[model samples]
Target: MQEVSATASLWKVALSLLVIIAFIPASLWLLKRFQLAQMKLGKTDIKILSVQSLGTKEKLMLVEVENEKVLLGVTSHTITHLKSFPKRGRPFDSELVQAQHEQVRQSQGDDK
Candidate 1:
């Protein structure tokens, strides 16, 4: 009787852990799907195009609002608009991004 109860308790623990592990990713996928649908419906005017973390709790975010682009400073407690500018030609330029990546790689190579 004692051996049977111990085996049953171990199985219960394993099942509980498996359920928790599965639940986390399932919930995340559902949330992402809902958010994407909302974006497709055009419910919001603002979008975050990119983010660079400045520190553990601070970041610089490039956001798009209507036809304008804005750079923002974000921290754990506050958000500040750093700059705003008119939209140039495209929302995102692939060539510009590629050039920036190349420059970063070259700089890292120089450091090493």
Candidate 2:
């Protein structure tokens, strides 16, 4: 009787340990699956189109919410809206493009 009780107690401990070991991986898998589901279902609003780094802890983000595109400044502690771009079908920076082309032409002329 004494030997049987000890064997039963040992089996209980082994089963408990096995359950705990199995639960860790199972819970991690469930958490990852839940996050993925949230991402897939939460895609309707607010999509980030681009991000540019300004400094170590600051960034500029161009995001589209609904139909409007807005530029935002992001930092460690705050997010600020810098500007809202015009509606679709208009150029963003025609002069900037022209200036860049002129610079390239000047550089090529200098090289020649």
Candidate 3:
């Protein structure tokens, strides 16, 4: 196998550092732009504490927007995909939690 010289290795590292430095400012600018755009779109200051099902068909979301509690009807096909951010918080569901715990215990027993 061929060996790399110290000067060449140093040059490669310098180039990589330069590339990262150049992208840093551009990435920051883009992120700021995105946030500014989102702000301009007029978003709500809602803190969704809990959500529950209204009935067998309709779904409801308990949202606290600007110190005011509102019952928002979740107008979506799938109730499980009601997440805006990555892992915001788990919704309350006693039956689902119990079922999941039972499944986990069963799986562990089977593995052993």
lDDT of each: 0.93, 0.93, 0.73
**lDDT tens per residue, model 2, 1-112:** 9999999999999999999999999999999999989988986778889999999999999999876899999999999999997667646598679889999999999999
What range of 10 consecutive residues in model 1 has the weakest lDDT sum? 86-95
Tens digit per residue, CA lDDT, model 3, 3-111: 5687788899999999999999999999999998987686768667786777777777876755555655665565443433333244558758988999999999999
Model 3 regions more than 4 Å off: 1-4, 43-112
TM-score of each: 0.54, 0.46, 0.33
Model 1 Cα lDDT, one tens digit per residue, 1-112: 9999999999999999999999999999999999999788987888889999999999999999996889999999999999998777754687689889999999999999
TM-score of 2: 0.46
Best by TM-score: 1
lDDT of 3: 0.73
- Candidate 3 local Cα displacement, residue 27, angstroms: 1.5
Give each model's clash number: 0, 0, 0
